[model samples]
Target: MSQMTLEKRFGQSTVFVASTLMENGGVPESATPESLLKEAIHVISCGYEDKTDWGNEIGWIYGSVTEDILTGFKMHARGWRSIYCMPKRPAFKGSAPINLSDRLNQVLRWALGSVEILLSRHCPIWYGYSGRLKWLERFAYINTTIYPITAIPLLAYCTLPAVCLLTGKFIIPQISNIASIWFISLFLSIFATGILEMRWSGVGIDEWWRNEQFWVIGGVSAHLFAVFQGLLKVLAGIDTNFTVTSKASDEDGDFTELYMFKWTTLLIPPTTLLIINLVGVVAGISYAINSGYQSWGPLFGKLFFAFWVIIHLYPFLKGLMGRQNRTPTIVVVWAVLLASIFSLLWVRVDPFTTKVTGPDVTQCGINC
Candidate 1:
């Protein structure tokens, strides 16, 4: 029954996209339930395998698994964040979702899983001071720290930049402000992804890890992997083939009409970002003498950029070279995609071409 609801939502999105394709030819955002789940999950999990504690939800896992089995914190922080980006917002929003519903459900679920950890058996830890006295406290502290990552400059990003430049303010140097925000966003996003991957992998990405005897049986991010696979199944059923997002595995630029530009850029390879990364290893040695500043940073930056660019490149090239075998590959696919994009293209299509959308294209615009 639960799965059916999920499927229905997924199907709803597919129908919406397919209808859009049939109607407008194809707008990029088909927002079916599967893709929504994947996006939400990815945004939440990313490189999740690298965090500690899993935050506060450990207690909710309750007596199901002893303390010895658990590592770090209890809550699946990334998973929690990922939940926010789901198809429909939760009924009561963040407060109710986390504090009440998630808490009760996860605790019961964990208990029901009947999984145990070696750590639970060895230590008086789960029942001791750390277990009862400070579960939420630990999570609160971690959550508080992450707040600065997003909270500090949000007002500035949304409004202050224009205001500051107009007022000629220099208190928080514009360059410093932008750099800080961008770096913080990138670093935190990556860290969040890594941590989510680790903590929720068992439940979200792959279920094999849940066997408790699997190679990664103690996997923290098992939740996300399992969930992601389920979402993938949802996506597969949705007929989102015309939707171009990112490459599944091998990193490369590809037709990324599906997702937003910011994410696609992250997938783009640094080498292609500029020749600097591609040739920097050798170039830095030579340039270091002339520039005085360490060429290493520039070189590294380029290489890093290339890595991102390469991932995006596959799709970009595939689409550009006309080599893309977007299955059901009759000319109809391209025609539909172009038409869909036109219906939805509010801005320039970029390096692809100037397939612009007009105010006239907006169906819901006030012009009506």
Candidate 2:
């Protein structure tokens, strides 16, 4: 089905470069008119000469990392249908980043680019040309364009629990109840579905789990950083350069911790989050002990949240502790700054004074 869609929509025959076809004997000289030759040259050099031209029918375009998806969105907005082809064996294979820092930088650039496209006049959702696009096509492009926006909420969720713990507050309900059960079930269902989707896409369980960890770490840190840079470009009229990821290979297959000074800033957010979570867990446990474990319910929630943060922080922690070179000096500075800020908040800001109460917990039995 996908092959047929690819053939019907984006078959190579539909895109004709007169010079190439003539040189390769794909199209005969007799068939190539002089006017068509001119148009072909124009299309090759600059994109779509006219919106109504044959070149406009081309559904997808591949260029630089940042421009590729933007081009696809533009074409789709112009009512051309396209599909991504992920073959078992790639049609083209290239070097991939072997280290987390490089990978995060690559995603940051993509996020910034996608955000730019989303906010542009050519945004798929609000563009005049978008009227011709089908609802699903428009939705797909919308999803692609706004994907980086998730970083905002994701960052909040990742840090909120630690903040609450520091302030001696519980955001989650205390007693196990119907609503909590429902929430737990929903979370499990979503997680299971994600695992299934990854498995179906030929990802191993370990790889999928590692990818999720990266998602949390990178999504909150690098993605949010990209959003900030992207906003400066879009709203402040600043120009940002596109970043290319390093494709350096590791000599051994095992993970190696190397100090990439350029990306040390990217480590700040995750490192700060790790420190906060560690502090929160230790403080929460001490507080619980002092309270005769009466605060076990809230303590449990804090511990669970800390556990989740630790899972995502595992790689970063490993890198930090591995060797002197593995831990960047800038990261330590950032961590210390964050710790001081958190300490001030804990002492003077008084987050606990204006405590936000949780949902009313209803007692429930095992069957209920």
Candidate 3:
């Protein structure tokens, strides 16, 4: 088939992407339809050979710092604190689509690399993708699902006053600080991730912004939703979902150091989200107290400081009173996910001096 026709076929839908990845044998054991689609776009890209590896670029050291060197160094100094955060993608274990099962490794490597550019830190292949496009993809991921979900918790915050007014549950009354803390956390995540993405992609914000938010929203939300699903499974003691790229969904049943590495890799998402939120909580509470009890933002303060009180303490007790099972881990992971999202808000890079990272922005013989 012509390259143009092949591209069209691959772009058909999530199912098509799934089928292609599965057919290529690159399908991850835990990959989701959304991740599969993304992999297809990159691997079979009819254009964009000009992409560069993002990790090699630095903010602006006059060709001094690489994207990976600068951002990773800074974030590492930050202890990669975002690693402690939560609501990461659960492990997906669905069946791989039939037919295409040949190009599995290439597709798996590509998908895995994409995850690294956006989330993974240990993967050396991540920096291979062009700085420009890699970051554009990451930002698209951030502004879409990660940020909006942070806003959902705001609904809880917005309703706090109403909850107090309506239920009279508090002799002291309270507002919801949950949302604000979450919002701040999400903001931080955005800032950190964005900075890195920019340095990696090497494309100016002007060029990135030229792309619409809707597509960003669609790509990002779809990606995270899948991840969020996988995260839920992690807490359930299930196998990690490798659904994003399907090189060969064949369960080798062969556990190796890589499995440990895969697991160790997970530390990045959870750890990043956890620490950032904790910091935000400290920051929020201090900020709230400084403003006095008069500020409704304190409600978020309380929620952040004492979600055990706000959610588990109250709800767990209520569940006990009603003889219900209150799975706190669910709530815990969700909270961490919220914090994970919060980190997205802070995503940013120092700017890379390299020309292109790779597939998305590689300059190897392609246009610079």
Top model number, TM-score: 2
Candidate 1 lDDT score at position 114:
22
Local distance difference test scores for all models = 0.33, 0.71, 0.38
Pick the winner on lDDT between candidates 1 and 3: 3
Q: Candidate 2, which ten residues in sequence have the lowest lDDT sum?
A: 6-15
Off by over 4 Å in 3: 1-263, 298-368
TM-score each candidate. 0.19, 0.75, 0.20
lDDT of 1: 0.33
**How does model 2 fare in lDDT?**
0.71
Q: What would the per-residue lDDT of candidate 2 be over residues 132-200, giving only the tens digit for each residue?
A: 677777788788888888989988787777777777877665656888889999999999899789878
- Name the TM-score of candidate 3: 0.20
Of 2 and 3, the candidate ranking higher by TM-score: 2
Give one digit per residue, the lDDT tens place, for model 1 in 8-71: 3323233333443353343345466776676556434534222322222322344323232233
Residue 353 accuracy (lDDT) in model 1: 38
